[model samples]
Target: MPTLTAYPLFRERSLLYLADMGNSKLKTSDSATAPLQLAREVLMIEAREVQALAERLDENFVNAVELILQCRGRVVVTGIGKSGHIGHKIAATLASTGTPAFFMHPAEASHGDLGMITQGDVVIALSNSGEADELLAILPPLKRIGAPIISISGNRASTLSRAATVFLDAHVSQEACPLGLAPTASTTAALALGDALAVTLLEQRGFSKEDFALAHPGGSLGRRLLVHVEDVMRQGDAIPVIEASRSLKDGLLEMSRKGLGMTAVLDEHGRAAGIFTDGDLRRAFESGIDIHATLMRDVMHRQPQTITPEQLAVDAVALMEQYSISSLLVVDQQDNLVGALNMHDLLMAKVV
Candidate 1:
């Protein structure tokens, strides 16, 4: 009963909607309307297929998981054609989720890529009909290698399924293609089944967000999980540290020298008493205060936002955005000045 959404306009019938919309047969005026109907019909078919396949989970799925979990070497996934493409994605998902999987093209297997598999490995083969020639060509060697096979296919009686130690049923009722010639619904069903296996294995392995972050450490995730405030914040002389008793002129001299647009004001005990920024100095100028006479403590914002060195850089970014500030003063657990960073620093690190 799921509603259909957008679909492939032409020739991308891979997502359970591979129906051959013979544009050659349609009248020019009806062409525009034909695509819409085709899209809706194909989407509906795929969604239902995904739902139905999900409900058809059986003991074979459990056996597949058990085999994968018991694997000593990496899981080698193989398939041909459209199924090969889906198998590649499933392998990626499995690897990123801590299952340690890789795709081995069946045709490439015949070209000696089969050496990638060892007795310690497990193989997940994909084919809608379970009868691809390239897949069958490597079955004997796969069997000889003593590696267990988990097959995902539309036919229970397929050669691939019959050869497997465990067979996961990804059979779909129909293809989204009007001619039933393309691998539409069957492919999606296989993908969903593969996802289920990967996710189930992920949970069984106790995979965590920290583990996922390690697998993806280049972008915002790295900034959030790997880069700490101390790793990126300016420390030592780079931080404009001044005493609260100092005059605004001295603060200005320190600020101008450090060029962080701000200076931290410390108390007699060397704890952060307050902070004075370029914005604060501008406001002070507007108020006509004497730069030589005003104490930094009196001219500064007394309660400034601060973070610990152990905090995440992304957290610092969040704090900066929330308060609409350009810089943040890094503090210790004892509230003493330790380091500082600005939006520009975040930009340089690509953390923002």
Candidate 2:
């Protein structure tokens, strides 16, 4: 008898067998390339499925969207298992994109949560097989409430699909899972279908980026999209202003008092002559100009950066960045100085 470890041929064969099993069970560096190819194939298959759904979109799809748009109540999406996860995401996407929607677990809905649905609401149910027992069990109660059902599933003949007022076929050719057991391609198809519905409804409703901002006021997009210069500018006494005949010392005093790092120098008629910023102060000091004797008109940078109060604050920030300047004088239609703002003002207002 020979020890298995001492036999070279046996050891080599065992190593090769282990490597083959590893490739089949876990995708490691040795099997990485094949999995990537499989992923591309799955994506292509899912994309085709989505395109098929898009092409088959007829008056029924139109009616579904119209139903949701006209409904005085929310859209309720429900599903079980992997579909439930997709339903949750779809519900969130719809809610954020101007559609009032929420996800209800079919199992939970049957267990007293069915009260969440009403006659005014539209229900979207997801079941790839269209035969989930819990989902099917809740269909009668939902239909009895007079809520229209939008079914997303592969099997059109299944109980849940047959119960729906409009069926959106989320059929896929194959699952990406090697064993064809997990919900991979099917979930992807369902998600894409959900996205299509959401985006279509969003466009039909004329959902603007501003509308999106209102839904997400705490995020950066809301700040960038909704904030106008008027909302962030320093108006009234907060503005640093001086007349043309004012001494440079007076301009500096206004800038210091307002703490905006600059002052707007107005002409005799109250229009802006120029702006004197801290940077301009440094230049004036280097030029040996006496702050007390020099008029601000003589030292100020004329035709300074100015923005309309109606301008978007994000655009104002772009102007500042492009000009490499920190402050802008805000003026109205008459060109009279209405306000002033700096990067600090934008920061304080959370518009930057």
Candidate 3:
């Protein structure tokens, strides 16, 4: 009857020995490196599996893409467990890439989500074993609805595959999991296959950057592609402008009143002649030029960088970066100053 603390050293050594015994290759002296070694092995296994899946691609893969392309309705992706998680991602990728698609849980399909399926729609089912009960339960209904089934499964002989309109094998030789229980390599292969399908469809449809921007209107991509200088530039009274005959002091006042750190210098004909920035003012003062006596036309930088109102805001950003300037004059086709913008404006619009 020894107390727990009476043999702490012996107990610690016993536990270490047991851990090493669990994996014959792992020893007490190098136990610290076990996790790193195992992680690398897992990645290698999954990578190899995906590579194998690529080489095994045949006409079945092509036929599946053709089927989805011909489908007039949405592509409905479904699965259970880990497969269901991968299915959800695949559906999102497809939908965002121009192919109309959605994810429907297999278990939910049996409980009335099946009504979402239409005759013209296409179904992509994911199941490593090809015999998931939840997925299998929905197959007959999916078939009855006249939707074509594209099954991605490890077992071609499984019921799900046999019932498919086109079966693409996503088989992997082994799991990345040390115990060979978790769906690691298999899920990786399935996800890669799904990506291939989505990208192929995207290319086939000639999906463009503008189309992608439309789907992601709230994202940064949309801002860069969809937003124009006219949408973010300061217009009307907000634009700081002064006639060429105006003094540098007048230009400074306009710049301050408009709070843009620069003023547009307009010619007698009311067209943009040049620009007077704070940098010019500083240089004028350093050169001992009287601000009140110097005309804007004399002190302003001639032929300042300008952008068209219809130009993309991202292009304006590029122009600013290329010239190492912060502000830009927005002009019309006739080079008339219609608006103005600075780095701050682009920052506010999140275009920078």
Candidate 4:
């Protein structure tokens, strides 16, 4: 035969043909079509099942929420394997959303973490087959404590389901996994159900953004939502203020010195009478008025928009947005100036 190097082009063409045939075979085969098609069909089916579970959510979900809401202690979630992982997430979501909850590994419970459960607490157990022996090991004691049990599982007839005060069916008709061994569709359904329960309880309790702030104190939402205008506003000497009879020159000097671009004019009783800004100074100058000779009382904008120091900094931001202004004067009930807040202040505070 001719040397293989002498036939390199033919060899390369043959290899490309083989690769194309292999890909074509894959495209036309049951092996390639079956898994993806089955997963899509199963996902649709499971999605419907999940929706039905949500719609037909009987007194059970309601009772479970009520049980958690009325719980004087924590909600302990327990499971094994993949379900255990999801249970951990559910516990975290519940805890962060006003329900006091934490994950307790079933195996750990067997080794005395069972003491974490007590009377007036609630137990949320998750298992796909609902027959995990590890989960069952501590059930009798958990039941003895009179803690109401909420079960999330596939089989309603499983021992875990039977022991529950409320059972949420997380059954998927088929696994999204091709081998049907991996927890795919079932885990998705369970996670969604857990979220539904957490959010439902969150809404029913009339939980506010401020309440969320308490749970997430380290985050920006917590700081912005929880901080009051007084907490972030400039107070006392930091405030830009001038008396009613002060010269516009004096107000401009105060504005420049305080770096707030504005100064509040206080009346005879020390109440905020008016405000003068750099913009006002420009308009006054354009009118041929003498800045050094004119009284701030005569040229300043009167009865300036004011907010209470008790208002939320977020609310102060809204006020700034609504009025199209960059600064606001915070005052007490008697209209006496207490603080000053500018757009830069809110930005620096990250309240915006």
Candidate 5:
């Protein structure tokens, strides 16, 4: 529970090095010398501390995950200082990964936000020293409401850990800070532990990508997974269409009018024969073909790729990326053109 620096040697050496550097520019500090070496040592120290925490994981982590899964209400996370900042991220991670959670500032809880905590809920209290006064103040109220307290703290015997329903040890031997006072290593360990807990609960709950999309409908991930081609495609008469016997000029007029850079060519049976694109027009011009008299089918790409409306928009993007095409023809179960969409549509819909 000591807040005192544990690595005097490191602190002493770092202080002496900084003193030698005086006011020299840190951006131009010699990579082989004191400044760079000091930064590396801090990183290595924090990294080692995190590895040590991971190596010490045991039944406590499993118990913590189980505690959360059994709760019928939201998980209320509470912490102070640096641990509080880490707690906010942990709560977000848990919520996004399918475990309902929210950060409840300990001070807010003391100031009557305690109403936010109710029965059947779980409390995740974070404090490295396990002596955060604001956090300790709410444990009795939480216990009285039949809520479980899960403590992530470095001190196993501290007041917070002793009062918890479950204790998760996140002890770090040293901080990345040379003074070992700012919570560098301990905060990282707590965050990593929180991630482990959230992921384990997510797997246990059988959380799916579909479920995630529902939780995050406003983001690109939702657009990719939830939006279908039918949602963004130009349907019915908006699709540019022409018969195979039509003049290339007729297809060009349809393309210009539709503004989709391409026109769908239908066969005599009214099924898709092929598609004539701007690319095909350029090739015809290069070959000196008669655009004014040639039939659409002769200059079009036969067996053009098409998609069904039920397919995901992201799948459509993948198809376009794979085929190197900006536009795609949408077909029905009967292999008839129903709609068309291009890269611009995807971009406008934010499905790109």
Candidate 6:
């Protein structure tokens, strides 16, 4: 029998045959490095394409922003295939950042979805080749509807670009796909361009955090931005509070009953005078103080950390973390104790 390595053609064929088998242990240096090398190249290609796009940006990009800004209606983004996927994300980002926008499938536009477009609306169409048949077929109707088209395409000379009110060149030198057929780098460029437009519109509209929170009301971001201290603070009798003249025993009972891990000591005027917590109780115990005889005013911490009910719950978390305390007292404009909240309250509210 001849050794496999004795014949180069037989050895190459054997390796190729082994590669076809699903779990073959045969390995080659080139095969091992190819994936990593190709991945890096893809990233580099996409990055270069985006950088080129930035350089090629002219007055047209500015005009596109102005057009969207002036429109009284929503921004209708339409595309096909991968471009449609990117358009969906672009529309979402725009809507969340202050621009009222939605993705409209180009094929569906011909099936009566065209009515979604109006004279006041601005249309953003994405097509790398600028010749997506479905996209081009609806150009005339979009024109007749009086909606200005902003075309993002790789080929500026394509029909879509020629018919557009403003053309944005999203051309890339080459695709990240080794075969040059997949829409890798081009899709990345289009996505980046869409992001640039959405963010620019957001800045031009002076979109604030509150506006963003409104759009994302179901997420943690909404909780952090929209939830105020009053929303999570335990109010009315739920507040663990005792008069300063009350005994430590009374304060402990209030803390236990409210389950806030602490109790607010109120002054004669019913203001938040101090705070007493488990730590204070332990120290008081170590000091050999009489829990029944000692007043809250004598054992409580005076002028403890306080927060306004109108403030955000996230801010309350910050104050707690800063002071290394587990609870906070909510006060009103006149320093009247209104409510109380501990870490558990915030955690239960999912504000933390």
Q: In model 5, where do residues sit more than 4 Å from their true spots?
A: 1-33
* Candidate 6 error regions (>4 Å): 1-27, 30-32
Q: List the residue pairs that clash in candidate 5.
A: none
Q: Is candidate 1 or candidate 5 better by TM-score?
A: 5
Q: Model 1: residues >4 Å from true position, as ranges?
A: 1-32
Q: Show how many residue pairs clash in every candidate, following the order shown.
A: 5, 0, 0, 0, 0, 0
- Per-residue lDDT over 1-352 for candidate 3, one digit per residue giving the tens place of the 0 to 100 score: 2332433433444567787786755344445665566567678879999999999999999999999999999999999999999999999999999999999998888989999999999999999999999998988888788999999999999999999999999998888765567899999999999999999999999999999999999999999999999999999999999999988888888999999999999999999999989898889989999888989989999999999998999999999999999999999999999999999999999998
RMSD of each: 5.1, 6.6, 6.4, 8.6, 3.0, 5.6
lDDT of 2: 0.86
Model 5 per-residue lDDT tens digits across residues 95-124: 999999999999999889999988989999
lDDT of each candidate versus the true structure: 0.88, 0.86, 0.91, 0.85, 0.89, 0.91
Residue-by-residue lDDT tens digits, candidate 1, 68-180? 99999999999999999999999999999999999999998999999999999999999888999999999999999999999999999999999999999999887887667
Question: After superposition, which runs of candidate 3 have C-alpha atoms over 4 Å from their true positions?
Answer: 1-28
RMSD of 1: 5.1
Candidate 4 lDDT over 1-352, as tens digits, reads: 2333333433444556567884644332344455566556556756876776677667777788888888899999999999999999999999898888999999989998988888979999999999999988888998888888999999999999999989988887666544467887789889999999989988988878889999987899998888899988999899999998988888889999999999999998999999988788889989999878899899989978889999999898898899888889999998889999888988888887
TM-score of 4: 0.83
> Which stretches of candidate 2 lie above 4 Å from their native place?
1-45
lDDT of 6 by residue, 1-352 (tens): 2355533433564677687677556544466665566577668878999999999899999999999999999999999999999999999999999999999999999999999889999999999999999999999999899999999999999999999999999998788765577899899999999999999999999999998999999999999999999998999989889999999888899989988789999999999999998899899999999989999999999988999999999999999999999899899999999999899999999998
- Considering summed lDDT, which 10 consecutive residues are worst modelled in model 4? 1-10
